[model samples]
Target chain A: MRRLNQLCCALGLFALSAMAYAGPPVEGALEKQATNWHAIIMFCIFVALSMGITYWASSRTKSTSDFYTAGGGITGMQNGLAIAGDYMSAATLLGLTALVYGQGFDGYLYMLSFFAGWPIILFMMAERLRNLGRFTFADITSFRLDQGSVRTMAAISSLTVVCFYLIAQMVGAGQLIKLLFGLDYNIAIVGVGILMMVYVTFGGMVATTWVQIIKACMLLTGGTLAMLLAFSQFGFSFHTLMEKATAVHKLGIKLMTPGSLLADPVNAISLGLGLMFGTAGLPHILMRFFTVGDAKEARKSVLYASGIVAYFFNVIFLMGLCAILVVGTNPDFFEGGTIGGKLIGGGNMVAMHLAKAVGGDMLLGFMAAVAFATILAVVSGLALAGASAISHDLYARVIKKGKATEAAEIRVSRIATIGLGIVAILLGIAFEKQNVAFMVGLAFGVAAAGNFPVLIMSMYWKGLTTRGAIVGGYGGLLSSVAFVVLSKAVWVDVLGNKAAIFPYSQPALFAMPIAFLLIYIFSKSDSSARAKAEIEAFEDQYVRAQTGFGASTASSH
Target chain B: MSSAMYERMRGNPKFQELVATRGRFAWTLSIIVLVLFYGFVMAVAFIPGTLGQPVSEGAMLTVGVAVELFLFIFFWALSALYVKRANGKFDALTAEVIKQAQKGGK
Candidate 1:
């Protein structure tokens, strides 16, 4: 995990000279290194603790309510930590740090985009989500519409978002495990997929929540420790750190300002839209609202979550800056033993390398284990959300017309969890060689355009009919995915095409408005009795959404 | 809830006030966030290097970093502010509205 930890030791304090030299080996780039024994031990402890919790949770998971929303008993603070854990993936640590390591201010700006989504969620979505939905967000969307069609559409979009998100996490897990534990890539993917399935299928949301809370705490502690240690090198002064970083970094003074990550106005705005609104639409994040006791707890969870995440991003920014001086100066971190050459474990290992440089081997081992646990906890959440869409929305509501027994639905969810896990493993391996950064962008894009538009309209607009929701949802879904396919990320970078059909890299700027307009137009034109009845139904839904009277109670199971 | 209770709640001035006040507050905060964030984005797009300038002459800290740090704390504070009002004043109003509606409906 420390990227040739022995070589770093043998090279000794000479690495402090900040001179460029050819790295030790030249043969395989992604080849296995010596096993990280300390990291392996720490990771084992994490796995054991999580598994024991899973076993405990399995006994209590009986009804569908218990399996999906933890019997609606989780407190605001616990759910807040859990949301932070689920939100801050390994990418938030590794990918963002690597981006800042390479691209500088651009990475920081990108991070700001991700963090901006929280207040929007708290202000606009959280309480209404808590009061209206029970098992899944689909419950809210279909509250006043035709359940079969609207729920079906919502389920499709939810799964689409979940699958793309899972792929990003799975690929990251595979690459990360391969580098850290010296394991084969395929084996790592399988191991992660199986364990995540076990968590969701057995312990469900309760187990997932605890794992996230624990992982959040570890990540916060580990990241803060690494940052503080690195900052100590320059007497805890930002100016001194920046001066040294710019002197050595290739970007020079350019690293302190905006760079190439967001150059195109359309792409930048679209990306900001995707990151901001997509968060409110994400199935796993939306599902957390149901785990809380009431709207008050839901609101508090978002508050605590926003605070923790905002603080953590600042830590990431500092870690990225510290790595420039600490890890970047040393050639032992590079593949060719050159200061500016490619990093050994690809660029994403900068944070780990920084941990080793500043806090020594022990901190690096702890961070590695925390990274593994982070991936595991996030994948479990995505799995639970995906399973609920299948079992609760599609199976029980659509197929069974909401008459399916709770036990039967729970069984379906467990089976769905196993299915999604296998799918994630296969996709992780299949796309191992592909550029996975777009997968995250595409997931957010789909969530924003495909899911968010329909959700907002349903919650706010009285004119929204089933036909309008279905049409708008599918339109947003297809167009967003279509835009990404034609965009530069997939068209040029991925497929090796000469140019992109869609110039912009993100889909939300164009896709979201189209979804809204379509919903408005179709709802306005519809004169059917069913549409009229749906409009009439909005009054009851609105009352419940505001006052929480007759809303689903906590600990209902 | 029954239609009679719903009718009563919809007619109650307190219920109306709660909805109006909460909606206004939520919308105000949402708009502020959108404007503040997108304003930064527009600045980045139109003038990318302005944020890159040092806060003071010869200073190493850039304006971009400083502004972002402020936004981070400010955004979190904004959420907390909304939560305090929503959970305290609005939530109590909601409970009263429900109680009133139930009494009148019965």
Candidate 2:
């Protein structure tokens, strides 16, 4: 009975999370459908291929450098593809498509904001990041500042951002697996957790990089093929496609206009800020710079990544429009014959249903597998970033005072991977009823507020002291989280409250400026000897950051 | 390298030129992106009705979509331009500055 009660709770969590995105709960038909054999077969193939890569990478992963940065052997083009793969998660593909399907012009804003970050990264952070940081982003912060305190704060912020990101991915994985495979939500969560653990614990960055690259290729191919098929239905005419989409959509021409979903100006700007700055703050994305050979390669990687991402987003925009005409109006996708009723699976499953509509069950199955692979790759990257923060930054640098052996550090990282995987699965269950896309937004909010300010200030501002960084980071972290909890989205909608204290859901607009102001005030007022010395060292650090003198080199091993 | 050599490199005209040129270029691109993106954001906030208007008479595409598509292409072009300049001009200057610094150390 106790075991049964636990099972019920897990199932309830899964159902709640799934229902939030997909819409009105229709648990009966989903459970009645048999396991999708084609999807299962394709998923198996992907797992086998990724596992083989992991085995190969485990053999070559001899030292801490190999485990963290793939021994810095990855080429610029390949790293670019891997970075694209890392950024374009299942959420971007499925969630954004659903948003477009539900709210037309509003979704394009998200795509624009998401792409906006890449150029910023290329212009500002990429080259300097490559020149300065070693294992983790904390390396850059601790470079000229007080190492002990700064690393601790950076590690905590990284872990906070990573865990939020991990929960989003895990929840997404559970929901997608349940929809595609007809698997129990609890089982799906466990499956993703275990696969992510295996990849990060044994294979580390090398295997993760290859997996991401392969997945990117598959995703691009699948998305392009879907786009071709979608366009073919309208005689390959963009005008006809738009006309058909408008004709079918209840909103008519309004579908082509903005302001349907994002009616609130403050929320729109706040959300925009979250996405624009958040990508720069993502530890996993920053960590990708360490995998490249040099600053030039790092810059090239962002260039290629931006190009690929821009192209992919363009295709996604068209695909979403197509899904509206194809999947949205199709009577077969409706739970009943009623047009305004629930979709067959949910709104989130629109892309998959459109794939089936265009290319039949085979394409649908293939797309499903690709979506699953997307979650796996992203979660593995997030788990690795979190593990590195714990083991590399906290355990080795802080606890051992940088005396921990390479072998010991790697061991701790592997252990941290397992621990994080478990924590993610548990959180995935807890937050199952919450909207995965909104959860991702909150993650971005925290990252933009917490990590972006400190990182940017530390890199650019000479007045940055260890106390300033710590206080400002915590200020951003706590304020963002507190604002989110108090916001209308969480308090009123999720928590069943009467009203929210915070009007807007996204906190980056207010939290980010507050964090920057705190850092500036603290840094300027700091009169300690250490702060003075750190200020004096800024010129040397700046020179090294620009010129790449004494930058860590790729090991021949 | 010694502090004297570091000071020499820092004081070098070539090094100063490299820093100034690169910094100016990066900031220029950054400011452009900031203006374009935040302009669009603010436009969306204040006068979204203008953005919602069609690009041309009898055209289905709204100003918002057309402008955004234009921005996307422009962003890629700007990045490519930055990369080309960095790889060619900036890198050449950087190499020369490093070479002079090494000579001073010797």
Instruction: Supply fnat for every model shown.
Output: 0.87, 0.44
* lDDT by residue (tens digit), candidate 2, A1-557: 62353335335544543443234323665742234667767877898788778877888887999999999888899999999999999988988888888777888877998898788888888889998898899999888888788899989899998988998899888887877777767778987897888788778999999999999998999999998898799898877887788888877888867764666778777877888899999999999999988888899999999999999998888889998888877888888756757887777888888888999878988998899999999999999999999999999999999999999999999999999999999999988888755567678888899999999888898889988888898899899988988987778888889999998878999999999988998888899999999998888888778777778878886
**Model 2 interface DockQ:** 0.60
lDDT tens digits, residue span A81-186, model 1: 9999989999999988888888888888898999999999999989899999999999999999999999999999999999999999999998887777666677
**Please, what's the RMSD in Å of model 2?**
5.3
Alpha-carbon runs more than 4 Å astray in model 1: A1-33
Q: What is the lDDT, from 0 to 100, of the residue A344 in candidate 1?
A: 81
Clash totals in order: 2, 1
Q: Which regions in candidate 2 have their CA more than 4 angstroms from the true location?
A: A1-27, A31-33, B2-5
lDDT (Cα, tens digit) per residue for candidate 1, span B2-104:
7778778889999999999999999999999999999998888888788999999999988988888888889999999999999999999999998998888
Winning candidate number (DockQ): 1
User: How well is each residue in B59-84 modelled by candidate 2, as lDDT tens digits?
Assistant: 77888888889888999888988888
| CA-lDDT, candidates in order | 0.89, 0.85
Q: Individual DockQ of the candidates?
A: 0.84, 0.60
